[model samples]
Target: MKEEFQNYIDYHKNKGGTGKLFKFELVEYKPGFLKLKGFFNSETLNPVGTVQGGQINSMLDDVTSLLLIYESKGTIYPNSTNLHSIHHRPLFEGEVIVTAEIIKKGKTIATIRGEAFSKDGKLAATLIHTALIMKSE
Candidate 1:
C-alpha cells in the first residue's frame, strides 16, 4: 500500500466514525483494487450465532467506497446508488477477508465488485456496488 493510502486507512481507523468502529485492516492494494481483513466478533453476531447481514454489507460498502476514493486520489467521492448482494453462507465470529475491484468507472457513475470470504476461505458473500461519482470539496 502506498503511504498515502495507509495514512488514509490509519486516519479512518483512528477517527473516521464507523471505520474506526469496524476496525478494517488493509491487507493489499493497487490501483483500483484492494483487500481488507475485518473481524466479525461476538458483538456482531445475530440471534443464530452468525454475523448479521447488515455488518457484512457495511464492510462491503466501505471496501468499494474506499477503493473508489483511492483510485480517484481523494478528488472524487463515491455516493452509493445501489448495492446488489448475494450471501452464499453465514459468517461466524472470525476474520472476514474482502476484496474490491473496479468493474467500470464512468464520469458520473462507477461500478465495483466486492467479495467476502470466511476465515476458512469459503465464499461467504458477494456484492456489486454502484455509486455516483461526485467531486470532493
Candidate 2:
C-alpha cells in the first residue's frame, strides 16, 4: 500500500477507537483487509463432529464489522444490515484461516467479503456482510 493509504488506515485505526479488539490478537489488519488464523479446537465441533456453522459465522461477522469500522475512519457501527454465508464443505477439527476484504465503503454503510480456508488451503465458506454506522461525524 502507498504511504498515504497506510497512514489513513493507521489514523483511523487509532482515532477510530478500534483498540479493544486488539486484545484478541487473533486477527491481522492490512490496508483494507483483515485475516484471522486459528485452528478450531475439539470443543468447537458440533454433534456432527464438524465445526459449527454458527461458530464460523460469528467469527466472520466480527471480522467484517471490525474491518468496516476501520474503513469508516472513526464511526461506530451499530449493527450489520445483511449478513450472508455459504458453507461449501465441512470444516473438521483442524487448522483454519480466514481472510476478509472491504468491497465498498459508503458514507453510511460498508460492505465486506471473506472466505475461510482449512489447513488444506481449500475454501470452506464464503461470507458477505454489510454494516450500518450508528454515529457519524
Candidate 3:
C-alpha cells in the first residue's frame, strides 16, 4: 500500500498541477503519517520577500490529504471540510518541511494536523484540517 501511494505521488509529480509545480518530494510515508520536503525560489516569494500564505496552505492541504489516503490504504480519500492555519513566522529562501498526521479517523470523517517548518527548525505555520473521508465505490 505504501508503495502504491508512493507511485501515485510519483506519477502525479511528473504529470502536472500543484505537485509538479511545487516539486514536492516524499520524504517519509507510513500509516497515519506523511512528510514532504519542498523548496521554493524567489518566484514564490511575496513582495516582502516572504513565502506566500497560499503556498503554505496548499502544502498543508496536500500533505494532509496524502496522510489520509495512506491511512485508508487507498480505499478512501479526503475532501477538505475545514482548514484553519496560524502563521508563526515568515519564511524566505530555504527548504520547507511539511508534515501531516492523522489525529482521528472515523467512519466518514477525519481530522488531520499539519505543520510547516523552516530550514532552521522554527515553526512557520500550523494547520488543523477536517475532511470527509469518502469511500470508493
Leading candidate by lDDT: 1
Stretches off by above 4 angstroms in model 1 are: none
Query: Residues 1-137, candidate 3, lDDT per residue (tens digit)?
Result: 44676676775576647777567777888777888887767777899999999888887888898777666556787888999999999977767998998899888888999999999988999999999989854
lDDT of 1 by residue, 1-137 (tens): 56777777776677666676567777999787899887777878899899999888888888898898888777888899999999999999877899999999999999999999988899999999999999987
Cα lDDT, all candidates: 0.86, 0.69, 0.82
Per-residue lDDT for 7-106 in model 2, tens only?
5445544664332222123446777787766556676789989999977776677667656655556457637888899999988876678778989877
On a 0 to 1 TM-score scale, where does candidate 3 land against the true structure? 0.87
Identify the leading candidate in terms of TM-score. 1
Q: For model 1, name the residue pairs that clash.
A: none
Top-down TM-score ranking: 1, 3, 2
Query: Model 3 segments beyond 4 Å from truth?
Result: 1-5, 14-16
